[model samples]
Target chain A: MIKMRLLNGQPQNRISMADRAFQFGDGVFRTMRCTGGAIEFWARHYSHLEQDCAALGIVCPSASILLEDLSRLRPVDAVLKIIITRGETARGYSVPDQLLPNRIVQLAALPAYPEQLYQQGVKVRVCSTQASWQPALAGVKHLNRLENVLARREWHDPDIFEGLMLDRDGFVIEGVMSNVLVLSDNILSTPKLEQSGVSGVMCEVIFDAAVQHGLQVEKRAWTLDEIKQSDAIWLTNSLMGLLPVSDLCGRHFQSHAAQLLLSGALKQLRQKEKFAIVDLAGMTKG
Target chain B: MIKMRLLNGQPQNRISMADRAFQFGDGVFRTMRCTGGAIEFWARHYSHLEQDCAALGIVCPSASILLEDLSRLRPVDAVLKIIITRGETARGYSVPDQLLPNRIVQLAALPAYPEQLYQQGVKVRVCSTQASWQPALAGVKHLNRLENVLARREWHDPDIFEGLMLDRDGFVIEGVMSNVLVLSDNILSTPKLEQSGVSGVMCEVIFDAAVQHGLQVEKRAWTLDEIKQSDAIWLTNSLMGLLPVSDLCGRHFQSHAAQLLLSGALKQLRQKEKFAIVDLAGMTKG
Candidate 1:
């Protein structure tokens, strides 16, 4: 399938070299699954993108403007990515007075992960590379992702689906590309992103669904020892939806019980949406 | 004079959107001053840029290739910036097997700062935004500079020349756009960048000159209180050379003594360089 790329609504694959995003990674992006010509969880994605941009003082492009750009792709069963940059400018870190935000919309083939992995769960490993401690940038999916790239490079084993990252203080923060959660005593606990980690949209959705299913939810710091002792562990992101961690650092977890309960709650939420679903799992229609 | 930008030696301003630098800031850069068609400290600038790229596992372009690119610019008394990105690739963080680095050379008009800043020293304020700690990327000047952008946004006062940044642990790091050094008693000291901050080219030069001038140099953790009590403070960068800090956090400092001693030492060093006789001020032939 041919991929589609649009820069500022133009069918272009190039941006100015001096663009702040190219110069300093001064940008934020959203990756959403586009199914049957409609974006899944688009509202949640846009809201997160706006908040990320606002955290860096970059003015976000209006929702209508972005939606218009998405429509231009005429996407169907594709992975859609939207990038909002502070725009092109002269040299230096101080923002220019007259700011023009750049919007890039791209469409690619949807990743085809084996269906069995969703049911059987995937294996993960702890990364040696630690996440930087920046409270100001925590929870915002900004473009400065060198640490994530480095962590993702630590393992070459195809069986290890992801690498979990810890902050400098040895607190479990997140995965290289997704947010992580641990289940213990029926309590669903995700890391507090006030000091590190990207707070994924799906993670928030899982928290809401877990609450609806009468489960305790906690957002706080977690250590490697605490995670290893949990009843179950899960990894979440927009594209991959959610998956249980069958093995993490040689420790096995059985997440079938909690998965069924929350999956049902998520299906109920998906039914209220506009898109027609073929299969509903973990708040994502696949 | 018109600014010149060369992408891979081609006089163009656009780069592929898929370039890793535009995507994940997977790149390194160097900024230097050109005087009468000759780049100031070209060897040191290239060495630092190469080391930074190596730290990130990128292949540094040959010096001959970069020098040729600079020669194409026909730069005379301008600001030159060199950027090397890990080329272009499809989505994801995994480094592709086939790698090609992209080189960008840009020449811009030299900034015309009031000479009084160099003569009487400049006032700098302490930034509220703290630098993140990532030991792996501590000294490398990579493109993940959103923190710098955020810290620089703290002040808009024209009189405030720079902002001093501290790490998350409250240890002095560097300036928003430069490296900082403090002189106390008869010793010169700079922050240890093993856990935070960029180890700039000019900062290394200042340390060497301070040592040759019979002044002791120290690199270690420094607190705001300790910095406030120092005999004098200074900021260093490739473009600005070195400037004394006259005022910081409303406290005035007398840097005249240190400035006279170090500037004289730097002037003697410049006399042996290839560049003709000019105003040799703080290792910069301005």
Candidate 2:
């Protein structure tokens, strides 16, 4: 298997058993798409990671060193998985007076995705398992993900591509791992990440693209009822770009202009990436 | 440090990086007290572990083999930690079809408790953090414990022994890791595990002891108000036999009866343990 190194700059095949992430799910992570030896949306992804680490009191990894490391490991095209844990060797829950937080960066081959599904869209299931809201941890891709794991385990059919999740209060938080956005009245509305939901890397890109492309974005409680009248439903994450939904819970929707435009924008971005790997060397972050 | 086999009974220095438990808090655990080389209340601990396994669909460890391993790893007085994760590999939100669920059991030197504190009592702080209610995982000691981990990090003082945790809806749930009980007017009420709280081994022992001793065991929602008015407040767990709380949020209580009685009963049971271990000689769980 291809490998990676711990942030201490050690060549390691395994992380310590006592790592806070391994011990208590005390960590946050980001999985980004890297093509032509360049990562997509490096600034937004690292910024979200820094914000989450700050919120959770995890030490932030320096972006310059991280980019340099990733540059070495980047293949022609691959997926980069970065995990920043609350460090190893913490006794119980007490954050040490001093912490050398550990970061792990792994390069892996991107899983094959159905390109046609982006055009035809995918089907999703509404899981009975609900995401419990913890305002302290909401919107961060923190490692405490049992709710998503439980929801994902509810079904085992390859036919069901993704599962949409809601917080215990019945507000649609997001998906098991990705962010959710629904279109209605020519306006695109995404669930607010203020209380709960992973503020995904791709979601930020879409939000930025929306503003640049003259599309409006709203952040509010997008309930299951709002889901019914929605024009188009789509899921976003770094790996699967933007996946439109053809059907959700047996209800069907047709193609829309925004979807095609969004798809085209992503394609253009992909093509732009093919030429120049945009600089992350001077990006400001925590 | 001494280490036992992995959950799947494989030998490993560290658990897999992709193990679901480490990744998503997708597991359950039981902590037991070993006196004279045998865990006190072994059957009840295993039963609770099995209950948690069933609740989360994790593979239950073979009781006899598990116990036998425990017997091998015990010190004359020790603390045993049995963490049973979902036994599935790390695949983000997905629990893959092929799973070799893992159990990691480790025995450490028992914590030295202030024997006099049991007689005089300890004090507690009411933490501002609140536990989220999730009925799907209520009562089980599953590892989605960011709440407990967060609260545990709230304080660190030898003088300040424990902290009280409340649910988001304003009901007292438990201590960071132990179960809580209050005594008022010849009636004892413990927070209902219906929503969120670890159904602890020692908590179960005390409940059984209370029932056997003809005490009213009311399991329901308990609030801070009821606790302040309680005749006595007590904490129960394997590591802590029974700790009487002198005060909670500055309100003092004289809750020594239930605490002493429960401790005395458990002490008597631990005096003879060779014959007390669970008889897994012929039982097959899987």
- Every model's DockQ: 0.62, 0.50
Clashing pairs in 2: B7-B102, B7-B103, B87-B101, B232-B255
Q: What is the C-alpha lDDT of each candidate?
A: 0.85, 0.75
Candidate 1 local lDDT, B138-162, one digit each (tens): 9999999999999999999989999
Candidate 2, residue A226: the lDDT equals 83
* Model 1 steric clash total: 0
Best model number under TM-score? 1
lDDT, candidate 2, equals: 0.75
Best by DockQ: 1
Residue B278, model 2: Cα distance from true site in angstroms? 14
Kindly report the docking quality category of candidate 1: medium
- CAPRI category for model 2: medium
lDDT by residue for model 2 (A12-94), tens: 54766677776688888888888765777777778889998887878888987667556555345777778888887623566
